[model samples]
Target: MKKEGCCLYYSRKSPMDDVPEEMTPIWSCTNEKCNGWMRDNFVLSVQPRCGQCDSLMEKSERLLPVLTNTSPNQKKN
Candidate 1:
């Protein structure tokens, strides 16, 4: 299984791979007071809120194939 974490950083990878880079969700927030930002794929169930602005953060972009989970019984081929 694979996992991802919340960070203000990401990489630009080529789209040739089966796991296309487009599948990744990108989030950004301008609220300086609050670190009010998080990715949908983040494991934590609680959503982050803007600390400084006291406002709800917003999703910036929608990526395809939101990878929710993987199964151990799945076929390798």
Candidate 2:
């Protein structure tokens, strides 16, 4: 018979594991406590606001995957 261990351990996979990413332009919330950010290209307005805290966001950079355009006419040069 084997004895069981008393310690409880857990391991979680990182969300970014195996995903290709690059430093891209983004907007981060100005609020110090907020960790909200958004891709610059995805925002509809010239000035963007944080979706999480409703605060003004500032220009920033983040490591993210290159998003592809679905339009056939939008081929990259």
Candidate 3:
């Protein structure tokens, strides 16, 4: 049993802590009030529009792990 005033606090690790990350292309909404962003690899078209506000998105890069599917037709074994 633990005492009320003597408890220890442990912070949980972030979900991305163990995953490999890289600087990849990203798209952010141009609208000042919109907080929309998307991984460039996940977008269907070269120029993607913001799904939240249907506005044009600007290209940028961010430190994020590879989260997009590179092979769409590859069979899973």
Candidate 4:
């Protein structure tokens, strides 16, 4: 029997962790009216068109800026 504070665990697997080696993500499209964007499996030969506007698409890398917390005194008010 397992103790109140101690227990045994078993190894588990998920389908999401089984991404094929050749799987590659390619940008589908981005809505100009909104910030919505999407990607599809290129190597997997899945949906190759934009799900939003059915527009032709290409692979792209999205970049996000990093923000650092500043001290209260450092903030200009």
Estimate, for each residue in 1-77, the C-alpha lDDT of model 4 and write its tens digit. Answer: 87687678776764554543443344745556533344342223343456567665566655322233344443222
- Cα deviation at 63, candidate 3, in Å, is 0.9
Candidate ranking (TM-score, best to worst): 3, 2, 4, 1
Rank candidates by lDDT, best first.
3, 2, 1, 4
TM-score of 1: 0.30
The C-alpha RMSD in Å for every predicted model, in order, reads: 15.7, 6.6, 5.8, 17.2
| Candidate 1 C-alpha lDDT tens digits along 1-77 | 87987778565864545564454553445665555554455523244445456565666655554465454533322
Clashing pairs counted in every model:
3, 0, 0, 0
Between prediction 1 and prediction 2, the one with superior lDDT is 2
Model-by-model lDDT, in order? 0.52, 0.81, 0.83, 0.46
Candidate 3 vs candidate 4: which has greater TM-score? 3
Tens-digit lDDT track of model 2 for 25-46: 9899999999999877777677
Task: Quantify how close model 4 is to the true structure by its C-alpha RMSD in Å.
Answer: 17.2
Ten contiguous residues minimizing lDDT sum, candidate 4: 38-47
**lDDT score, residue 43, model 2?**
73
| lDDT, candidate 3, at 55 | 96
